[model samples]
Target: MEISRRRFSALGAGVAATTLSGTLSGATAAQAETPPGKPAVRNVVLVHGAYADGSSWAKVIPLLQEAGMNVTAVQNPLTSLADDVAATNFALARQDGPTLLVAHSYGGTVISEAGLAPNVTGLVYVAARAPEAGEDFAALSARFPTPPVTSGIITSGGFKWIGRSAFLRDFANGVPRKEALVLYAAQGLLSTAAPTTSVAAWREKPSWYAVSKDDRTINPDLERFMARRMNATTIEVDSGHLSLVTHPKIIAGLILRAAANS
Candidate 1:
């Protein structure tokens, strides 16, 4: 009995040692990827807004991944604000540690609500809406000149899509034609109503914003106003609404900065 007990104890110790060694190696590998002076924020959740799905982030995803960060681009069912938030939260819940929550277009509202999750360390808005909780986002945008893309929205069965003409000319102005066609075909059908969030996470969380200078889908002034209102670190990209497609490197840089600061 004593001999058997000793063998079991030795086996257990060896297993524990292996586990500890693996954990340390993993930590070292992750840390190694982060450049000095940049604290590592290893997980990133990207939320796409109305008229787009996860594929909207195709260009940006590889950039983030190449930097050795785990990135998830959320495919929100644009049925309602709550639904999209749920989808984002689902992605956030899967992250292992501190995460940067990034959003585009109407996705801003989603991250605002879902960013309240404890794992979320920061919020990054790329040409996204950032309305005050319960504020009328439609009315707010109306205060700005109605974007030209508004004319192209076609609605049926309570879901909305910007027709190909508007998507090509206004939403995807700077994107290559071949790629823009794929985006148009795969755009999410958004809810016609722009619902307000109950709470804006940017109210307390650290944040960053990228404003597309030639955006026609959402007013650039509105994006700037929201960024200023949230006191977010802001950068302006000289691209249209699809800056994530045409100016991915700048977007990736902004996100990396957010990750470092998170």
Candidate 2:
């Protein structure tokens, strides 16, 4: 079944389907079709996790562009799960053909809810939380030993973010110091409720995963469990939670592999 345009509205989040219109224009159907022998999926939509903006995908975007793929990185509002899913759905709605939906960190949750879009053909989770339908990610992650970054969270109002020191030391440890500093500076504050939404698009879609072996923010062990649970095509990389930033080449490659399969 398709994820309805009224999904968030049905949940009392008040997100209007018309909000998707601005991002919904794209290539004609013929131009959007994948060339023969190329990946069956021609569009790639990226969703960024908590404490990040779409710029979080900067490192991977050019690589995908160089490979001749149409790519769009979603700017999640980080206000709530429903809002983030709405933003992601807006991007997915714009794709003209088969599309590969990719997520990093908390973005995995957003894609899990939005990936049911009719044109979404596959999912790639990069060191992300992949909770099953009716699962509570916070409770799920709690089953694993708490990671270092958990202690660094600073909640203000209803939004949360890792402290700068923790963002650099625990979350983005694999990233270069200078770059990590900039990422920390641009971090988005995330709603605490996002993780409680239990939808699992990976359950219905062919999925791939890249687990960051050295991840301290989301527990590498938890990543493995989720990857296994989804029966995803999985790979492990030596990196921190922000693998998409620190290990873009392999992450992008995995995404390409998922796209090719579509």
**Every candidate's CA RMSD:** 14.3, 12.2
**TM-scores of the models, in the given order?**
0.85, 0.84
TM-score of 2: 0.84
Task: Flag regions of model 2 displaced more than 4 Å.
Answer: 1-39
lDDT tens string, model 1, 148-239?
89999898988889999999999899888998899888988888776779999999899888888889999989988998899887777777
lDDT of 2 by residue, 191-239 (tens): 8664665578888999888878889899988988998898887777767
Q: Give the 10-residue window scoring lowest on summed lDDT in candidate 1.
A: 1-10
lDDT of each: 0.80, 0.78
Error of 1 at 205 (Å): 0.5
Q: After superposing candidate 1, which stretches have Cα over 4 Å from the reference? A: 1-38
Best prediction by lDDT: 1
